[model samples]
Target: MKNSQLYKGSLNTIILKLLEEKGRMYGYEITQKVKEITNGELAITEGALYPALHKLEAEGFLEAEVEKVDNRLRKYYKLTENGQLETANRLSELEEFIRNMQTLVHPKWSY
Candidate 1:
């Protein structure tokens, strides 16, 4: 689904979940991971990603650390305690959303 507009609210949830699974990741890594998982259907742009990461950090949902890789300083993000809690909530919400969508799209199909 190219150009399948992602809801802005779910952005944080997606980032938090990814960080929870992968431990720590840099900006590029985060974008790549999402793209990989979605099979190139959903692409997270740097513009959207950086602001979300910063917002999460500001909200105490994440922590950042800097590391040197190949003579470049890369900032890595990891979930905080609050982030863990947020991840659980977000995942549940995402699941519910998917279930509701399935019900709407396949009203006569029983699974």
Candidate 2:
């Protein structure tokens, strides 16, 4: 993202959520999808994206399959059983965070 620090903490959750929605996606596909979803406001760099993907894979939250598509090999990631469960938890946490931030940023006026 343009403001990386603000969004860095949520990267993993974002990835998991996207994978949950897309079923399976390659790294570049994930990056492009996020760009498309956010209308280019957020851009995930390879430096950031790969590590998150690797970490998720190591945590058993994702599974990767390598296949030769057309001419080049592509790695596709799909959510595992644990990932499915984690996605729910991550989304819930993210929703709560957003609500909290909203309250803090725009508190209701009381007389």
Candidate 3:
């Protein structure tokens, strides 16, 4: 699936999980990682990714550090203490949402 519609609800959780797994990542790296992980089923565009990153940073859920990588000054994002907690909370919420969706979609199937 192109997964365009699914981005809104899951993007934050996805970003947090990636950061949780891989310490720090830059914008392009984050987009690549998401594509790699999902086998290209989901693609986060630069336009979408940067704004989300900025929003998270503004919310104090993410912290960005600037460093010179190769010939470019790349901004790497990592989670703060609040962000770590928020990640866990967001993941839980996502799991609950999945379960709820499964229930609604498949009424006969119970997990």
TM-score of each: 0.88, 0.95, 0.93
lDDT head-to-head 1 vs 2, winner:
2
lDDT string for model 3 (1-111, tens) is 766686767888888899989988999999999889889988888888888899999999999999998998999999999999999999999989999989899899558
| Model 3 steric clash pairs | none
- Residue-level lDDT of model 2, residues 1-111, one tens digit each, is 475788999999999999999999999999999999999999999999999999999999999999999999999999999999999999999999999999999999899
For lDDT, the strongest prediction is 2
Candidate 2 global lDDT: 0.96
lDDT of each: 0.89, 0.96, 0.89
Top-scoring candidate (TM-score): 2
**What TM value does model 1 have?**
0.88
Q: Write the per-residue lDDT of candidate 1 for residues 70-96, one digit (tens) a residue.
A: 999999999999899989988999999
Q: What lDDT is obtained when candidate 3 is compared to the true structure?
A: 0.89
